[model samples]
Target: MHTTALVLFSGGQDSTTCLAQALSKYERVETLGFDYGQRHHIEMDTRRVVLANLRERFPQWAPHMGEDHVLTLAALQQLGGSSLTDEVAFAMQADGLPNTFVPGRNLLFLTLAGALAYRRGLQVIVTGVCETDFSGYPDCRDDTMKAMQIALSLGLERRLLIETPLMWIDKADTWALAHSLGGQALVDLIIEDTHTCYLGDRVHRNAWGYGCGTCPACELRQRGWARYSARDANASSSP
Candidate 1:
């Protein structure tokens, strides 16, 4: 059984929720992020903000929250065909994946996280890669995570579990999970602090969060918020 975790936190909704989930389950939890030369670099800032908020507001999780590490991978921008790293429009490719799909992004993140975990003496790696309501990113799939887990364990010569709490859930369910973990406070933090825009637009704030509302990331968040809020409202009104 894994008692300690290193969460791949991007300072986004899914990642923040994953951090909460890990803190709830593990005895100790650390966070890791990557500065992958994304056009939307605000995540690097928002991630820290989110971590600070969690530590301050949630006393139960404060002690377990440990050191946070960030890595800069300049190579992604150098090899970029994706809109996330380059000055390009978002569109689907002939291969059926979105232009926003950064090739080998999750894979590389996990590999590096594994190395960091080894150095830091962590037991498991947690990420918030969901597939049930995602934009068809192969790296976010269940099979890909499973394969990566096996590879990391074998390469490290030690058993390391890869935990994906959001893998089987959709966006609305993700919202519900956040509520369960940290209640309305966490939901408010996600809405006010987490950054998920592909364009990194922070000036315009929406009901869900800050982002270019039309971007795939924002669209999913907005849609999920609509469903979650509607359901919560109905539940509250029920006798």
Candidate 2:
């Protein structure tokens, strides 16, 4: 078991769940976020609020939560082509990948995270990347994660483990995992506080969370909520 962990937290639903899990399992867990010039800056904006709430709401995990690091990587905007790094409208490319696919976002995030984890003497790096029910981002694949873990350990000259708790789970299962980890309080915290809309639209709120309810992220989240709620309803009616 790893004693120390650094979560690649984005203040979104997935990352927040990962953070909660890290806090529960690790003796010490820190968070690392990147300012990659994303068009939707709400995720970055809400990081502090989420952390504060975690400390306030979950006393058990509060002692384990440690330092938070935010790195500014302006180079992403400089190398812009994707919708996230650019001012272009979101669309599907001829190659079938969404315009929101920032070419090297996850790869770059993991590399910087490895460097920071090495400096911080962290034993594990936790991330929210998922292969199932994701937008087909190749970087989120289990194979990609496995390869990155090997590469980071080799390059950093440290025995580092990359933990992807959400790797094989879809969004509904993700909600179920959160409920298992921290129960209804956590589920409520995630729905009310987490931000996942690509547009950073917090003006509109839904049963699942605050989002635009149309973007890929919002759609996935809403779909997951539907399934999760259905299961809950069925379970309640069980004999």
* Clashes per candidate, residues 3 or more apart or on different chains: 0, 0
Q: Per-residue lDDT of 90-149 in model 1, one digit per residue for the tens?
A: 999999999999999999999999999999999999999988899999999999999999
Error of 1 at 189 (Å): 0.5
TM value for model 2: 0.98
Score each candidate by Cα lDDT: 0.94, 0.91
TM-score per prediction, in order, is 0.98, 0.98
Segments of candidate 2 deviating more than 4 angstroms: none
Cα displacement (Å) at residue 139, model 2: 0.9
- Residue 204, candidate 1: alpha-carbon lDDT: 92
lDDT of 2 by residue, 99-194 (tens): 889877899999999999999999999999998889888888899999999999999899889999999888999999999999999999999888
